[model samples]
Target: MRPLTNTPTRYSWATILLHWLIALIFIGQLVLGFVMVRIESQRAAFELIQLHKSFGFLLLGLIILRIAWRLGNKAPPLPPSVGALERRTAPLAHLALYAFQLALPLSGWALVSVSTLEIPSMPFNLFVMPNLPLIESDAAEGFWAAVHWYLAYAGAALVALHVAAALRHHFLLRDQVLTRMITPSSAGE
Candidate 1:
């Protein structure tokens, strides 16, 4: 059986699971965000938006856990073939990823909180989430909405870049970067 925690050279099963789970969910959320807005029916749009919010909340919690896990564990080192620029920028890219992962949800929450519609967010319809104490106004809502929208596009770009880089490592560099996440045992090969 696969190990539960990360080893010195590869991510543990838990980390791999969380990483892909967050990636898939975030991608779904991005697609949903675009599609739901184009929905014609107000009722249909509202339902999809609520689902989006719930998923956002889920992403928020998962990201927090991921960050905590990363902090507590040492990530496997980048391969020696990686250049100095990549080594320097890689951490910055990761930092941006974490920041966007966090900022996207909080901005969404803020957008909903200050919305003129005053719609309460019920994550998965399980419970009503409390709104932030910001003064409710059109300006506040617009600001948060803009923040949320822009951050989402930024996040999409980052995800694309991340994937491209990983592919480069896998196919071009012919390194263990991608394999380590997919098959931990391969890290030792």
Candidate 2:
């Protein structure tokens, strides 16, 4: 059985779980966001938008926990096959991912908060989530909406690059970069 914490060569089960869960939800949010805007039915679009907001809040919470966990735990090192330049840039790339992951949802939250419609965000109908204490006006709403839209697209591009890098490490480099994330480290065994 794999350990709950990170191993020298493998990720902890918790890390693996959070990684995939966030990835899936983020991807779903992107798809839902695009489709919801283009929806012809007002009711359908509103429903989807609510769902998207709920998922965004959920993502926000999970990411907070993920960041906490990551800070507490040390990551496994890259294999020797990786070049020095890649090694240097990998941390920056990861930092960018973390930043985007945090920023995208916050932007969405800001967008909803400043919306002139004054819609209350009830995440999964659990409770009414309060909006950020930002001024509410059409201009504020439009600004945040633009920020959210641009961030979403930019974050998607970063995610694509991240995936390509992982695939390159796995297929071309023939290294354990991807597998370590997929499975537990075999350091002890």
Candidate 3:
């Protein structure tokens, strides 16, 4: 079996898998969020919203695992070709990505908790997930809903920036930044 740990020159298979999975799911969740909001029928909208909530909870778990894995493994170093400014900023950018990965779901969960509707989230329809113990208030619900919405947009922007940076590293800089994540070499640097 392939080792699941990262090396100095390339990310482990685990990291690669988690990264892509989160990216795909996040994109799908964004599309679902927009589509569900536009759903005209109340029943259809409720079902879609429930699905969205399930996926959001799933994302929360995946991200928590990813973060734990990342902390335990030493990530590959930035290529020597990378600039000083980029090197300094890259960690901050990553921190922001992790922050959003966490914040978005928690905010959504909180929003559901304080909502007057009081819908229970069943992740993947496996079982009922308890809501956060937040006081039921219209004002609180609105606040968390707004927070969730804004955070989603902000996270989307960060993802776009991340993709642009990766493309720049791949096409413009001709570096290993993008390749390392996609297809890490077995040979050590």
Candidate 4:
């Protein structure tokens, strides 16, 4: 069975769970974001927006925990099949991924916080999430909205690149890079 902590060659169960959960939700958010804007009914769009916001907040929380877990656990070394250039750049790419993952949700939150409409964000109909301390104005809203939109698309592109790299490592290079994330290492295996 997969242990709770990482092994030399594979991720811990916690890390695998967090990684897949974040990926699934982030992909769903991307789809939801694209579709919500095109909805003809304002009520339907509003509902979808609320749901997106709720998930965004949830993503932010999970990201924070993931970051903490990552910091506490060192990732396994890249397989020897990985080139030197890739070895150097992989960490940079990961940093960018983490940055976008963090910034997208924050920009969305900021966008709503500064909206002229002043609609309160009630996440999942559970409770109202307080807006960030920023001056509410149309200009601020526009700025944040642009930031959020750009970040979302850019983040999506980064995610695609990340997936491509992982696939290359798994199929092209025929390495354990991808499988390590999918399955935990067993002792003496």
Clashing pairs in 3: none
When summed lDDT is taken over every stretch of 10 residues in candidate 3, the lowest stretch is: 180-189
Error of 3 at 171 (Å): 0.8
Question: What ranges in model 1 sit over 4 Å off?
Answer: 185-189
lDDT of 2 at 9: 82
Q: Which is the winner by lDDT between candidate 1 and candidate 3?
A: 3
lDDT against the true structure, each candidate: 0.91, 0.92, 0.92, 0.92
- Taking the tens digit of each residue's C-alpha lDDT, what string does model 1 give over 1-189? 666677767888788888999999999999999999999999999899999999999999999999999998778888888899999999999999999999999999889999989889999999999998888999999899999999999999999999999999999999988988887533342
Our model 3 lands, by Cα RMSD against the true structure, at 1.2
Per-model TM-score on C-alpha atoms: 0.95, 0.98, 0.96, 0.97
Instruction: Write one digit per residue (lDDT tens) for candidate 2, span 63-175.
Output: 88999999998998999899999999999998898888899999999999999899999999999999999999999988989999998999899999999999998989899
